[model samples]
Target: MKAAVHSRYGPPAVVRVAEVDQPSVGDKDLLVRVHATTVNRTDCAYRAARPFFVRALTGLARPRRAVLGTEYAGVVEAVGGGVTSFSVGDRVFGYNEGAFGTHAEYLAVPHDGPVATMPAGMTFEEAAPGTEGAHYAMAFIRVARVRAGQEVLVYGATGAIGSAAVQFLKHHGATVTAVCGTAQLELVKGLGADRVVDHTAQDFTRDERRYDAVFDAVGMSTFGRCRRLLRRASSGR
Candidate 1:
């Protein structure tokens, strides 16, 4: 199997495509012939050992795992014994998460680990990148306890997580306001944001209206900066 491997962490240049031994299938695992995978911020963060603390998991001086991709869409070529959830020829998409070994021609994933049949009408390329954004957005939505008719604001609303947040909030019937660069105002609106703020031309914090929740999807803003935007409880206290 050929995979993108990085023996040491530094920059994008450290990664190279090389042939490596394919993963062995465990009794609960499925051997997949990878059709598509996505290189996302998590991959870059691990590769660069950014924030410095990530080295605790990746490695102090080098990466623990040679292969770096986290998300993949592939077809099952062989299923290990006891694995009945998927079989040969099944199309699946999922993330490896902490294990992190999907950037290859073949990958072995446990049948029960985040793996799911690809939705109808979605291609491998389209489904692979969707998981990263969807996962983060779902986490924030769940933690915030977002509900229908609530007002929500998403900052940096054009990137992967931001765009997904806009759509997810809108789908749940929340009135979503998105902040992005001028070039992406219409793009964010198309994702179902009720209002779009151009971060370049305007300061969203100056707006008088408050929201049930304020999500800085890109980590570009802090809770202190957005506290004024969050709705306050009534009773004039």
Candidate 2:
């Protein structure tokens, strides 16, 4: 199997495509012939060992794992003895998350992991990135306990997580306000945001409009900066 492998932590130049030994399936694993995968922020973070703190998991001096892709969409080539959920020829899309080995021609994932049958009418490339975006967006939505009819704000609403957050919030019936660059205002609105704020033109925090929850999907804003926008309990005065 050929894979994008990186031995040292640095820039994009550090990674190279090389023929590596294909992974073997475990008792509960499925061997997938990867058709598509994504180069995501997590892959870059591990590649550069950014924030310096991430080294604890990636490695102190070098990456703990050679392969760096976290999400993949492909067809099952083989299934392990205990893997009854999926069989050879089943098309699936999912995230490896901590396992991170999708930047290759093949991947071995536990059948019961995040893997699921690819949705109808979606291509491999389209389905791959959705695993990461949807997973994180769903996590944030659940953590905030978002409810229908509540007001929600999504900052940096154009990137993977941000875009997914906007759609998810709207799907839950939250009135969504999305913040993004001017070029993406219409794009965010197409994702079902009730309002779009051009971050380059105005400061969203100064709008004086409160929201049930504020999600900084891109991590571009801090909680302290968005606190004023969060809904406060009425004093009944």
Clashing pairs for model 1 are none
Clashing pairs in 2: none
| Model 1 per-residue lDDT tens digits across residues 29-145 | 999999999999999999999989999999898889999888999899999999988879999999887898889999998888889999999999998998888889888999888
The regions of model 2 sitting more than 4 angstroms off are: 234-237
Model 2, 1-237: lDDT tens digits are 899999999999999999999999899999999999999988899899998999999889888899989999999999999877887998999999788999999999988889999989999988988878888999989988888998988898998888999998888999999999988888888999999999899999897798888888887777778888887851110
TM-score of each: 0.93, 0.93
Candidate 1 local Cα displacement, residue 181, angstroms: 2.1
Alpha-carbon RMSD, each predicted model: 2.6, 2.9
Task: Assess candidate 1 and give its TM-score to the true structure.
Answer: 0.93
Model 1 gets an lDDT of 0.89
